[model samples]
Target: MTDKQSKAREYVLADLVDATNEVDDAMNLLTEARYPVPAALTAHLQAAREQLAAALTIAKQGDAYRPRCAHQCPNHAHTCDRTPTHLSDHRDQQQKGTHTCSWPNEPDHITIRISGGSDDLVEVEGCEGADEFNCWGIGLTGWRGDLIGGTDTETLRIYAIYNGIWTFAATASDESLPMPDWPIRITDHPDVGHSALVEIDAPAGTRLTNVTALGGDR
Candidate 1:
């Protein structure tokens, strides 16, 4: 399993155990009470019981909730000892040069390339129709893609790439704008390609060797 998944499972289990203990304590308090049970206390006990039941349902799913690791290390016998090799190593190799791209309307397609000084070249492209109007931007810190409409509204699925890996990607849309002068309208579809480029931190002593175009859904 991935480290993030493992950590999430651990947190859920810990929360379940604590909820169970609270339920048990509430039950004991009810049984040993010398006075009539207060309405508020009774309501709290009921709530705790319900929460415990819900947590138990999730715990029973077992492997369905926690799957095995999809990728395995090939060089287990190597001298290198890294906890998370894939993510850690990839980030370490991306700090040598600047990765830049231009976002604008294209008649045929838009191509983005990452130059990895003497290393492999990474390129990504998106196509536009013959008559269809296309305008989009690259989101350095989040997911890349334009919404359905050309409105300046930010949506979820935008993620920030940190330490050479994608992280902190989330989306939120609502009826009212949370803050005034927030460039993106809450109701309009988000046009997110012109935002600031995000910088990622690289581990010390690691040099970027190559960048290959990642082909797939962002």
Candidate 2:
């Protein structure tokens, strides 16, 4: 880890310790001060504290605890940086293409295009002011990226034109479009001023073409 990352992890560990302490204090008062706390509630607090401790243990390991690539990859738990060689035992099991991290270590903004395609996957090409699709999260964009209809972030919407009709495919953080075989069209809120088109099945000679974004503030 870099000096900055180590420092950040330390800060996170400290915050977790503080939170654990707070929970312990609450449990103590309920059990020792003769307060008539419900038995079930105290049990819940104990469980919460245990969960926090488990999280703290994992946090202490820093990136060592993070998955290296796709979850199904055999070396998923191996602590390789951006360019670590694949462990020999798992050579045949490695992911195709160059090794890529399963996650973006930083925030991922949702201003991108669909730059590539595969049998079952479409590459989300992050553009200026955005980060590449890190292999984990809701759909294409990971947890940090703003989904077209993600409720937690600035709300915009993504629509799909299929069989001569436009249909809603996303509406909140937990909702997003499935990998599409047909051409995809997105019309952003007029105030947002962004429009996009994605073709998952382009002509044979061309790559899955364009997630071209028209003029916008993104």
TM-score of each: 0.29, 0.33
Name the regions of candidate 1 deviating beyond 4 angstroms.
62-218
| Lowest lDDT block of 10, candidate 1 | 180-189
Residue range 1-218, candidate 1, lDDT tens digits: 56754554455556556656766776798889998988876774665464344434544443212321223122111122225544432312122223322222333222211111111111122212111111111211112222111232422111222112212211222225321111111111123221222221111222221111111122
State the lDDT of candidate 2 residue by residue for 1-218, as single tens digits. 44644554565566557767877887878878655778876875675575455545655644221222333322122223333354432212244455444433333322334421212222344332233222221111111122332223233222221111111232222235442222222322232222122212111222212121111111
Q: Return the clash pairs for model 2, or none.
A: none
The candidate that achieves the highest TM-score relative to the unseen native structure:
2
In model 2, the runs with Cα more than 4 Å from the true position are 64-218
Global local distance difference test of model 2: 0.34
- For model 2, what is the alpha-carbon lDDT of residue 54? 51
How far out, in Å, is residue 214 in model 2? 42
What's the CA RMSD for each of the models? 20.5, 17.9
Query: What are the Cα lDDT values of the candidates?
Result: 0.29, 0.34
